[model samples]
Target: MATSKDGVKLDKSTPESVWKQILSAEEYHILRQKGTERAGTGIYNKFYEDGVYKCAGCGTPLYKSETKFNSGCGWPAFYDEIPGAVERHVDNTYGMRRVEITCANCGGHLGHVFEGEGFPTPTNQRHCVNSVSVKFEPKQ
Candidate 1:
């Protein structure tokens, strides 16, 4: 296991077969297959807590609670991710150009990121995350 910049352990769990054992069907769909949950149905959609949001696949800390904000985009929205915790890629899978975000460690899909939406955030970006892709750890 390799550790990330923040000292979060980055397990090299890869390939579909390996994840099928650790994640449930729902989690595997979103994190492994790069699928998205229905809007407004994620557990973190309306959740506002002071904690760290970690990648469900590799337990790498991805987002800080303070970066979370309600964008009313029907998903968990954050303005920023923990430094070096997430990776972005130009995604054109569905014929729509979007930047897809994934865990830097395990390469698990988190969600897409949108920029310049004119939100009241410092970064003016929305990191739309799938609740199934992450787990929350409340700040102690």
Candidate 2:
């Protein structure tokens, strides 16, 4: 098991083919091909239950319920991620510069992180994630 910078255990050995088999086509597209879900259509976009959002690809815990906020951006928005659970990359696709966030463990695409939008959150960074990229686990 690989661990993130904060020592959170991660699994990186799962083969991509296995992921392809495990995920639906939509999930594979969003999580593997970096595709985005249509705005306002995500299951989690309006859900506010207390839970942890895990990467749909590898089940790595990514965000907590407290970090979630309605950014009105038509996606499930989080002000932050579970420390070291996600990683950032420079994405220049679609003729725009953006910071892409992914599962640090499985390298699955979650979405983009936008900063300085002034969302009244501690980080002020909006994690614009695809709903198909995460699965919610209610607090137990």
Worst 10 residues of 2 by lDDT: 1-10
On TM-score, the candidate that comes out on top is 1
Steric clash pairs (candidate 1): none
Which candidate should be chosen as best, given lDDT against the real structure? 1
Report the lDDT of model 2 for residue 110: 92
* Per-model RMSD to reference: 3.8, 4.7
Candidate no. 1 TM-score: 0.91
As a whole number from 0 to 100, the lDDT of residue 129 in candidate 2 is 96
Q: Find the 10 residues in a row with the least total lDDT in model 1.
A: 1-10
lDDT of each candidate versus the true structure = 0.90, 0.89
The Cα error of candidate 2 at residue 114, in Å, is 0.2
Model 1 clash number: 0
Candidate 1 lDDT, 18-124, residue by residue in tens: 67776799998999889999999999999998999999988889999999999999999999999999999999887899999999889999999999999989999
